[model samples]
Target chain A: MPKLWNETIEEHRRAVRDTVLETTAELVAEQGLRGVTMSRIAERSGIGRATLYKYFPDVESIMAAWHERQIAGHLDELADLRGRSDTPGARLAAVLERYAFIQQQRHGHGAELSALLHRGGHAAHAEQHLRHFVRGLLAEGVQAGEVRDDVTPDELTGYCLHALAGAGELPSKAAVRRLVAVTLTGLRPQG
Target chain B: MPKLWNETIEEHRRAVRDTVLETTAELVAEQGLRGVTMSRIAERSGIGRATLYKYFPDVESIMAAWHERQIAGHLDELADLRGRSDTPGARLAAVLERYAFIQQQRHGHGAELSALLHRGGHAAHAEQHLRHFVRGLLAEGVQAGEVRDDVTPDELTGYCLHALAGAGELPSKAAVRRLVAVTLTGLRPQG
Candidate 1:
């Protein structure tokens, strides 16, 4: 094949894969995890079963891919937010508020779907990346005298993440902001 | 029937139900939720299949009942801890520490078990009770000036629970304590 033809084919493949992943996620969100199947995803994505198989082996794999993309996007967003602010504590709060908002959107998906999306090793990798990102910001906050120095960065990182997890069950965006604010306050050094 | 006979039968029935629930929980801990069956539970408890059915309609109901008992036990433990401490802040810290330890013990129960146990209405009720308990402590802490007064007790209650949830994944008891300590520090007013 010509070079132009090869590049066009790769681009088309990427587009189709993204479409399939998005369709699968929508189906999973509307129905429970058990309700999703390859045929269902294929039909929803407007692709043939054979073409869908070429992109993903099964529904689980497709969901895993979707989750990976979501995590990557989230990490990128947090990175961007970190750059926008000069103060380390302020940056941490911004990232946490965004993180809490993300969690709040996941409410009412049903536990089964949440479990399926968070299952497997890739989710673990994403968690580690998130923790490391938070820990770095916390260390910066400590040096700036905005975060408490009594606890190590690693411990503080766990505290922020854990506290923010409650955002998923919060009633509104304002509540999520309050959660972040309280968490940041908790990080300040004791008198 | 005689009153004495009726009392004896009621006591025996209670004993049998407790045995069945205990046996089912142990089976679930050993195997995933899907591996458990009424027949297996009946056999393990040395009860007739008909008798087991009399206690619970299905595995899910049995699990719910077991979860209720667990929640009740946890609430009782927290209440007991509350009575032992003189200061509001100290009581809150003690309860958080115990709660963290409880989470740490759940580490090896497998994610599937955790998912199954957290799936129903009883879990929601338990959470409400836990939050209410924590909120009360936070209110007391505020009066003592040990906890920040800027946030409502409801918000701080959420912070403590969310931060301490990470204890479920900590590497050791000491790590769990550190997590609680950091969480407590966060509750203090900004200096």
Candidate 2:
């Protein structure tokens, strides 16, 4: 095949895969994970069942792919926020606020879905990446004398993440912000 | 009936019920929740199926009763810890440490059992009581100027509970203690 033809085919395949993932996510969100199936995803995506199978063997794989994509996007957004901020303290604050809001959004998805998606290898890898990302920010803040150095950066990272996890249960965005503030306060130097 | 005779019968009933709940918990722990049935529980408790049914209609009710007892015991333990310490700061620390260790102990119970037991009216009521208890300790800490007063006691209560929740995933008792320490640090007055 010609080079242009090969590139076009690859692009088309990528587009189809994206469509299937998006359709499966919508079905799961509307009707829940138990209600989704391969055929339903295929039909919703306007693709043949055979074509959907070529991209993903079943609904579970499609959902996993969708979750992976979502996690990556969130990490990228946090990284972007970090880059845009002027100081280490400001950067950490922005990233933590965004993370809390993300958690709050996830609270609406129901426990079953959250439980299913948060298990297994992919979620673990994402969590490790997140810890590393936050730990770096904390180290930066500590070097600048903003964050407390009494505790290890690693421990502080764990503290911040666990503390902010409560944001998922908070009733409003303002509550989420307050949670972030309290969490940030924990990192400040003691009197 | 005579009062002595009535008291003896009530005591017997309570003993039988306790045996049934303990047996069910052991069975569930060894074989997972799905493998447990009323028949197995009755056999393990050395009681007839009819007798068991008179006390608890099914396995779920027995489990709920067991969970309620456990929550009540934990709350009582925390209150006792609070009363033993001399200073407001020491009292808060002791209660928080005990609460974190309690959470860590629950980490061994498996997610299915935890989820099933944490829902519905009884769990909600227990949670409310826990919040009130912790909030009172925090208020005392604030009055003594040991805790930050910038945030409301209610907010600090939520923050402490949520932060210590991460103790459930810690690898050791030491880690649980460290998590509790970080959580307590978060409540200290700002520099």
Instruction: Mark the 10 consecutive residues where model 1 chain B has the least summed lDDT.
Output: B106-115
How do all models score by TM-score? 0.85, 0.87
Error of 2 at A176 (Å): 2.0
Off by over 4 Å in 2: A1-3, A31-40, B1-3, B34-40, B86-88
Candidate number with greatest DockQ: 1
lDDT of each: 0.86, 0.89
Error of 1 at B71 (Å): 1.3
- Expressed as tens digits, the lDDT of each residue in A1-191 for candidate 1 is 46798899999999998999889888987886888999999888899999899888998899889988988998899989999998997898888889889888866676666777787788899899999999999999989988888878998888888899888878878888878877777788755
The C-alpha interface RMSD of every prediction is: 1.4, 1.4
A30 Cα displacement, candidate 1 (Å): 5.5
lDDT (Cα) of model 1: 0.86
Candidate 2 lDDT, tens digit per residue, B24-79?
Answer: 98999899999999999988899999988889988888899999999999999999
